[model samples]
Target: MFRLQFDLDRIIGTLEREGWVVIPNALSATITANLRTACLDMWRQGLFHEAATGRASGQACRAEIRADSVLWLDQVAALPAVQAYNAAMDDIMQAVNRGLYLGLVELESHFAVYPEGAFYKKHLDRFRDDDARTLTTVFYLNEGWPQQAGGQIRLYLDADCREFVDVGPEAGTLVLFLADRFWHEVLPARQQRLSVTGWYRRRRSSMPW
Candidate 1:
């Protein structure tokens, strides 16, 4: 078990100025290795399902819009690797609340596998019916990902969404951004791509059944 240490000042500063940041070596080597193994095991066991778009009643599989498989993370009785990753995320949540005052209450994550030729269309993390999602985080688990692999995440910058940057899915690399502020997409890959994708949400009021 390794202690998680991040440059809080740098992260906050970047978020405040640019609305996003990419951090390399986000996870410790041990944790990253364990998570990669766990993801592979899950993939081999056929635990992942074809990812869908929309929310709740509106959710539907649209392969043309996006093609990938995903397995949502369980909060209770999670595996060791998941627990460690969650703990690290909790630390990040605390720091984010203190720095940005976003009132983030919880995190939800999933293991996503993008097989060769799979890609997701440009979209925002937040849904129309739900505004609780405040921040998006993605940690890559692909080891030795080549520059030519073509699984880069392209993020459109600023309000106009004119400029962009391509981020490779390299192992231990983490990308964080304001959920509604950016429109991003996953480009087609020449090889398999793996990642843990998650979102931090603002607290929601309880609704009566």
Candidate 2:
């Protein structure tokens, strides 16, 4: 088996320098495809409910809350797709050892879809209710995408603490970034865009000042 390896120092160094890092193809094609199918299936089965928010551009999506996914636990936990995603996270966490510096980290997975013309306005992923959110992970689930698709993910780096970087929404692309450092948003989608996103939460015990 080809053991996928990453330069831990480089990963940590980049996180400090750029505030974010991209691990290309962290999941194999086979694994990615399966994950895509499973994610789409979850959406199709009506497992998710539309979220009421100020941002909406004709895209339809159901936010799968991490704390309330009990209705279809078997559908999500038994699938190899979720396993693969978790595994990828394991690999990343193992390499960077972000845990060593941050205490008691947690992740909440949310599946989202934006159909044609759907877009998300500029915003931050961290929850304002609390400062527990630290990092954000966005794993693209689309395949055979084109540049003009317009479903691009723009992630700004300290762009006035509002917006700065634009990450590609291409299939199999994974974006890892600081959740509260800068503002980010998704542009209008020429076609449908699907992705799995979650936050790596940090507690006071780990990120104390």
Local distance difference test values of all predictions, in order: 0.90, 0.66
Q: Where in model 2 is the C-alpha error above 4 Å?
A: 1-8, 52-75, 98-100, 159-163, 204-209
- Which run of 10 residues does model 1 get worst, by summed lDDT? 1-10
lDDT of 1 by residue, 123-177 (tens): 9998876788999999999989999999999999966778999999999999999
Predicted structure with the largest lDDT when compared to the true one: 1
- Give the poorly placed runs of model 1, Cα more than 4 Å off: 75-77, 205-209
| Candidate 1 structure, TM-score to reference | 0.94
